[model samples]
Target chain A: MKLMDKLQILADSAKYDVSCSSSGSSRSNRPGGVGNASLPGICHSWADDGRCISLLKVLFTNVCIYDCKYCVNRSSNDVRRASFTPDELCELTIQFYRRNYIEGLFLSSAVIRSPDYTMELMIKALRKLRHEYRFNGYIHIKSIPGADMRLVHEAGSLADRMSINIELPSVSGLKLLAPQKDPASILEPMGYVRERIMESRELVLYKKPQPFVPAGQSTQLIVGATRDSDLKILTLTEHLYRRYQLKRVYYSAYVPVNDDRNLPSVNTSPPLLREHRIYQADWLLRFYGFKAGELLDEGHPNLDTHLDPKCDWALRHLDQFPVEINKAPLEMLLRVPGIGYRMAAKIIRARRVGPLGFEDLKRMRVVLKRARYFITCNGRYYGGIDLDSGLLYQLLSDKTDSKVMAGQISMFG
Target chain B: MVYVTDGSFEGILTAVFEAFRNREDPEEITLGGDFQLSMTAGIREISTDTEKSDRVWRGVESKISKESLENLYMAYLSEHPRVGLYIYRYIKLGLNIGRKVEGYLQHPDVHAIYDLSRRVGSEAHLFLGILRFKKLRNGVFYACYEPDNNITQLITDHFASRLSDQAWIIHDRKRDILALFNGEEVIFTSGFPGIDHEDCEGEYEELWKRYFSAIAIESRKNPRLQRSFMPRRYWRHLPEKQL
Candidate 1:
């Protein structure tokens, strides 16, 4: 097949894997290398789907051996399949990297023939890019679920990041949708990669320290493909973070492409709002220091689609409301609905100079529309309504949610 | 009364020194080219001196903090009309109370410098990814961009090291500035004619444009959201956006 046709087929198949981050690694260019990895990462463009196009996200090939019902590339599906030669993949990455169209390459592939064989081809492509072309830029590769440990380790040393997607939330869901894929096959590599990452960190002072997965591991969970509670998904995400020390856990709303009795109908829209809510809760877990228990309980088994998770949590714990902005600790400020991490830090920094008034908060650009309900600037409540009134709930629930789409991050603070 | 400096960063620093030496608070401080002849009352032209500017720069470094000095410099790069006056007032408060002035969000002058510095800093950072290079027929990679602030110098530092092995030129069309990197050193030129490239829209660009469109999930198409992250202003130079 032509290179353009191969790229189109492979990229279309790869579009569902929504892990496009290029951060947590800072590999500098060698004396004659062509590129470098940035610490915070850079987004070359945003796709029409509103996702950041950081790396040249494409699959090495789209032919699979397993029939995962929710996946577009499941072997049973009647879709076009194409594979790139090692030279073809390397040339595409370097040329795009030279033009600053991408920070690096995100190379994933289906289980072609076998897991180990697919991984071998991927490593060959990666080696050519790194050794022959001297490409020091970021390369994030996916470990085919059941790939051998030694092969994964070999690939880890060459690539900046490695990930294994946990597509289903529950074991039963995995069995119903993808019976051939075992849960052990998914978690085993995650455990091994975590160990290798720990080893690399311990050997930071080695005279010739070889880094392994310098950007660390991340995974994607397919939301709404099966009957999984937000609480269940979030608990698993928190477990992944605490156990594996994963850099990020992306949630891709299931876009039904294949017809299956167990899968949601293809006519149904992807649950994009639920995915956005999960991401909001994900941020709360990672940065806001909130626990799964704090955000949800048996009574509220799902995130409220009307209000964000942070706002929902604040409304439930009204005893913590009206905390004095001048006296509240950093943790308390973070719990406020409209204040993000940067804004919370800014408030703490600005308040240290003198008592901050509402005017100062406005100047500091804190979104008082929601934060006002929870915080008191100078022993005065500007949120207007009484704290105990249920009216705050009606007022705080987002109405102009027309802009609230999945992967559309406003980042207002 | 106003002070006119020689329209350089060091010249602005020297004006700060003169404010301290003469013990007179000027109404405004103007860079040389920005000065108007109509306002001639009590206007003093402050000459640039490395010795005096260095003293002021070092004082800001030792007394306030290195970051504040960096912030002041980035704020100066905004080239705002009254940016010199804002920097003067910001330094006055910063020297009085040291680095704590960074957190003085209520102060108008401090907020001005903080906001401008962050704008310039973030734009320079944004240009790092927004820049697009097309391979010219002559074999040199060429890209063009138009930024609001004076950030060509800031972004070129990043490309110089990242693409050091290849020859490239980044043209800032709005300011008519060029960052020419010839496999070794990057030279900044103001106006030295132009090289021609019709942007042949080569095969690689076609592949990139195809990959760009294919990677987007069709079910979740939201053009408004795409514009928010990659704004309309930058779409002019983006290769895939052209499609």
Candidate 2:
């Protein structure tokens, strides 16, 4: 098919993948390549979900042999099918790059003939972009489950990053939804790639060859598809970080794109807000010293729909509140519901010079509304109006909404 | 007495330097009223001089980090209140702190500059993505934008290298500046004189608008969020806005 037709079809299909980030890579242009990737901020394209749009995420072909229940491109589903020749895809990317339409390409494919065939096609596309077209822009390739180990290795060398979607949190869930794929098929390639990246990092002193994935590996887990608890999902995410040294664990709120007797009805949109909360919690876990158990449990397996996970946790663990602003450690300050890493850094810097009182905290742009009730700096407390739970909720509700009010103040603060 | 510029970021930065050299406060300066009247006591126009500008740029570079330098560039792009004067005083204040103030990335002045920079940076990034090109009969390519901040200066180099094979004109209609790139070189000009408004064939624009509308999922129509990303002020120049 023509490249634009393929782009329209595959980008539409691949929009549901929801891990379209081109951040965190620092690859520069080679001698004859068309582009480069900036570290601090590169270009990204936003999906319908309003997340940062970075990658030109698209599938090579929507034609598949496997009938994954949630995918619109499954074999059983009657959908328009398109595929790109390596040259066509490379030319389209270079044109788009020249026009500033995209930063990098996030190329994935459904199983066309076999796992190895699909993997080889993807690798060939990347190699064409790299060697034939001399396009050095960031390329994120999807690692096909059950692909040959050697093909996966070649994919890493050509691409900046590779992701193999775990699809489901558990083996039973995987079997129920995507019976054609199994756990080992996905995990094995990821394990091999992870080990290679680690080995390359270690050998950097003695040897100069960097492995296939410089941005390292990332994977996606479908949220709200199975009855998996938030706790279970977070635990799996934590393990992915611990075991695989994965760079990111993306949670795609499951949107049923195909009809199946076993799958949930496609009437309801994915709980996007819930997915957003999970991401917030995920950020906290990765950057803010948060544990999985701290945010969820067996009984309360779901996050509160109204309040954010951190705020929910803060209310549940109120004793940890009213943390003395002048004395609390950086970790504890970061745990405060309103305080993020940026705010915490500000507090640390401000406190270094002198003692910070309520006024100083206010001047430093702390959300004194929510924070005042939770902090006592030098015996001054300007929060918790009436100290009644009902009143506190009302006061907190007004103050906690920093989104709209963030504009009233200098957003730089 | 001090004189304020017209709230344009460059005007503010120019005034800031004037205030510091004359040992005056920015708050006392007003754009065309009492301050200008008082300044008539014996004032001079700060002509845009290359050496003076380069020296000021050097002061900004030495006093602040590269990030802050970019921030100052963005701050200069804004049409905010006292922005020019604030930038001028900011540089002088930055110089006095020796170097410790450079780490004060959260200072209100720093934050303001940072915010402006992000807005300009975001617009530059978006123009890279959403910018649509047209083939004029003259064989010149053209794209028009109404960016939230004056970012036409920022995106020229990107377009220059990317479209080296073709001559292109990127016009920031809101700022009345055009980055014109011939096949060989690029220059920032005030305006395009020969281009006809009716030359908009409107077919490609219609197709782009249709594609935009089709791609926007109704299931996730968060206009609030969309507004947060692409503000309505820029809607006037957007092809989708014509619809």
Candidate 3:
């Protein structure tokens, strides 16, 4: 088949994975190398779906042996199958890099013939791109679930980042939809990658550091795939972060592509708002001092779809409000509804100079509309209304009209 | 009094020097050729004096932090109409308050300088991703861009470090200048007009266009969000936006 024909089929099949970040690795260009990786990733283009297309995300092939019910390229599905030769894939990447089309290659594949076979093909393409073509750009490849440990290790050394998708949030869900896959198959490789990364750090202290996934590893969890509650997902995510030390946990809203008895109805719209709320809560977990248990519990098994997680948390714990912004610590400042990391840092810096008032916060570009209810600048409250939860919820939620809410939700859907 | 400069960064600094040396508050500062005839205020044309500009820059460097120095240069690159006077006020305030002046966000001049500098900096950062190169017949990649701010010089190091093994030219069509990186060193030159270059014939461009279209999920097509990130103003040079 033609290269364009294969790219359309393979890239379309790979689009649902939705982990396209190319940041966190600063691989410099060698003396005769063609590219370098930026510390903060660059988005080459914004797709029509409003997602950043940072990497040339494509599958090595769309032919699978295992019939995962949720996947587009599952074995039973009668989709067109195609695969790229190692040389063709490397040439495509170099040509696109020369034209400034992408940061690097994000290569994934279906279980073509066997896990080991698929991984070997991916490693061959990466080796040609890195060694033969002398390309030093960011390359993110997938670690096949049941690939050989040696093949996984070799692929890790060549790629900047690697990901092993958990596919579903729970073990029972995996059993119901993808019986051929098991949790151990996924976690074993993740454990190995983490160990090697730590060993590489230690080796760096003694010798020239060899890059083994310098951008770190990340995984994706399919939201709304099964009847998994937000609590269950968060619990699993927390475990992954603490145990595996993963860089990111991307949550892709389950878009119903296959008509399976186990999956959601084909007519159901993806849970984009839920995915967004999960991202917000994820930010709180990673940046803010909030733990997963603090954000959601047995009483509230799901995030408030209308209100953001921060605002919801603030409203629930009103006793924490009315904190003096001038004297509050950085952690306290970050808990405010509208205050972000950058704004909190600014407040900390500016307050060191002198006592700041509400005007100072406004001039510093702080979003006072939501923060005023929770903060007191210089012992004075600027939130004119009384501290009523119902009133505040009405005010905050009413500001976003239905049309604007739809626009915002669909932007990251 | 109004002060007119020669439209270079040094000329603006020189105008500030002249304003401070004369101890006169200029009502306005503009580029040399942009002086409007005023009915009452006197106009002074300041030549580009490297010695005076360097002294003023040294004073700024010693008084403020290195970050503040970058802010001043970025604000000058913004090319806003009243940015000269705003930067002058910012420098005067910074000199008085020492390095703590950056935290004085309440000051109008400080706030204006910060906003202008951020605008230029963000635009330059955006082009680091948005700029696209097309292979020419001579094996030198060429790209053309028309950014709102004068950021051609600011983004050279980024591409130079990334595409270090290839020869490339980034032509700023609006400013009529080109940044040419020939594998090792980068140099600025006058922009050249259309050349007799043939487009490379390959399936890679076609493959890229296909991948670009295929990756977007059809269920969530949001052109407004796409425009917010990659605005319509920059669509002219993007290969995916082309046929």
- The regions of model 3 sitting more than 4 angstroms off are A398-413, B35-38, B195-203
Q: Candidate 1 lDDT, tens digit per residue, A210-313?
A: 89999999999999999999999999999999999998888989998988888889999999888999999999998899999899978989999999999899
Question: Which CAPRI category fits model 1?
Answer: medium
Candidate 2 per-residue C-alpha lDDT over B1-243 given as tens digits, one digit per residue, 9 for 90 to 100: 445345443444455566657676544334333343553344544434455556566777776655556677776676554455556655766787744554454466654555566667777766665665665657677787777677787777866655556678888776788888876677888855545767645444443343344334456555565556556776655555565
What is the Å distance of residue B103 in model 3 from its true position? 1.9
Q: Is the docking of candidate 3 incorrect, acceptable, medium or high quality?
A: medium
In terms of docking quality, model 2 is acceptable
Sort by DockQ, top down from the best? 1, 3, 2
Ranking by lDDT: 1, 3, 2
Clash statistics: count for each candidate:
0, 11, 0
Q: Among these predicted structures, which one has the highest lDDT?
A: 1
Query: In model 3, what is the error at residue A300, expressed in angstroms?
Result: 0.4
- Per-candidate iRMS values, in order, are 1.0, 4.8, 2.1
Candidate 1: where is the Cα deviation over 4 Å? A406-413, B35-42, B193-195, B199-201
Which residue segments of model 2 deviate by more than 4 Å? A1-5, A41-49, A206-211, A353-365, A386-413, B4-23, B26-73, B91-97, B102-142, B157-169, B180-186, B194-218, B235-243
Backbone clash total, candidate 1: 0
lDDT of 2 by residue, A1-413 (tens): 54445566777777666565665566666543467765544533333334445566778888899988888888988899988888877876765555455677889998899999999998888888888877766788899999999998999988888899997998999999888897999999989999888887788779877756878889998887887878888999998998998988888777877777777788867766667778777887888899898888888888775676777787787766678887899999988878878888877876664577876666566776466777789766667453336455444443333232111111110
| Residue pairs in collision within model 3 | none
Q: What's the CA RMSD of model 3 in angstroms?
A: 2.3
lDDT (10s digit) by residue, model 1, range B125-146? 7789889998988788888888
